[model samples]
Target: MALTLHGGRPGTDYDAAWWRSVFGLLGECFPGLPGGAATAEALGFPWADQTTPFTLSEQGRTVAHVGVLAHPMRLDGRAAVVAGVHAVGTTEAWRRRGLARRLLGEALDWVDERFALAKLHTDLPEVYAPHGFRVVPTHRFRTPPQPPAQVQKRLLQPLRHAADADLLRSLLRLRTPASNRCATADPGWLELTVAALSGALSSGFWHIESHNAIVALGEEAGGALILDVIAPEPPPLAVVMGAAGAADRPVLWSFSPELSCDRAEAIPTPPEAGVLMVRGDWPLGEPFGISPLWEH
Candidate 1:
């Protein structure tokens, strides 16, 4: 029995059965991933139009899959298109069948015709290296603990309401690059960033009314981890500290912050989540960082 290959933009080419099968495959491939339907409903939208998925189905059940996110970004103050490959997986029963490789080749062939660069974050770099992908140094930015400054912290409201989601969507639409060095120019990836964080980190959404920013933040023994800052303009470090109320503690920026690299220490990101891999000429020769949250 041969598997059938299906491809299309989500919501456009994928129907109800396709959603169930693909989302089911995703949950099986990655533990603790939120159900796609619920996440989309919470945001009052479907998947982004830029995302195109390819799946291998055996008798209507999706067994292997690969997703391509058309990421439009600003790299070193210029616009670039990146085909972000993600969710490449095959069921255990289908392992060693070369199903994933087939889908990957198909996806890449499509990518080559349209985009110059391609990227993906994976725990298994060896799996993709044969496809001409190489790890690129990724980083996190950090700032020294501030002297206890007395400033009224802004109020932070959890993103639990429709209005909160809408606010984030609007900001992402007009958002300035978190860093002129590297940042997403389109809102789709940002929206997916929040959607993907919908489960464990869903509570991390913090709306700073004063600064007009939606911050994805988490707490750790080290200090606060600002995962990604979504705002028209990346808020000043002071504003983020005030909003997070962490003026006296060291702050780590998972995403590139607006602050000068001189002020924030840049360190190589751990490969715990998988190394960042690329497939073409990366324009940013200088040190730069994009939030892991932006990864699919």
Candidate 2:
């Protein structure tokens, strides 16, 4: 069969059956529904119009979905913000067939005109690197023993959802100006963020809303937390840095060193970092994905 590309329309976010089917396929490729859901919601939903879902189909069948989100947030407090790109998935049958690369390429092309940088988290570095993406570091904390700064923490207050058009528009307006920081923060952006926080996957999750952010992590038995922006985002770093502070130390992880301690550094180079590749206007210590949990 000739490989075909189909773009999901505005109203076709996906029906319950469709979502179930897609998730089922993902469980096979990635496994772990809750974690996959958490990652998917964080990455996939951010693209597509707030109420809409961005999907790709092959010969009338939906096989993959990748999100393209653009709003103004910067890297290192610069004027450019990363064109947030995430959640590229394909069915098991589609593996090694170039489906995800094609789908994500479309998303990247769409955002290229509007933003200066692109950022995402993926274990697959070689896959995205060839597509113009450079890998950035994905951070996980050992769960710092004491709050880093102690500014005062407020978890999950409220942000607009993907369904709220007016509010969603407002959020985009607020998010897409600076391109150097990390991640996209639009309305549906926050909805998916909050959605990730609702399940068991949210155990180490923290949404410091007063900081205008959301972050989740699954700590492995080895004491490393796996963090890939579970929710939308928190307030400016300056705020969260003050209140919540870092978790515990003896921490070995991926994200920016600022999230850990003055002594933070990289963990083992993930196979995906070199494969996925991340390129941005701002310089990241690594190229996987920047964490919204702590300010760098």
The reply for model 2, stretches above 4 Å from the true place, is 2-4, 8-59, 79-81, 137-202, 205-276, 283-289, 292-296
| TM values, all candidates | 0.88, 0.54
lDDT of each: 0.71, 0.46
Pairing residues by index, what is the TM-score of model 1? 0.88
The top-ranked prediction according to TM-score is 1
Query: Candidate 2's residue-wise lDDT over 209-281, tens digit each?
Result: 4444433343344444434332233344333333333354233333433432444344554443332245555
Q: Model 1 — which ten-residue stretch has the worst lDDT?
A: 149-158
- Residue 73 of model 1 has an lDDT of 81
Q: Could you give the C-alpha RMSD of every candidate to the true structure, in order shown?
A: 2.6, 7.5
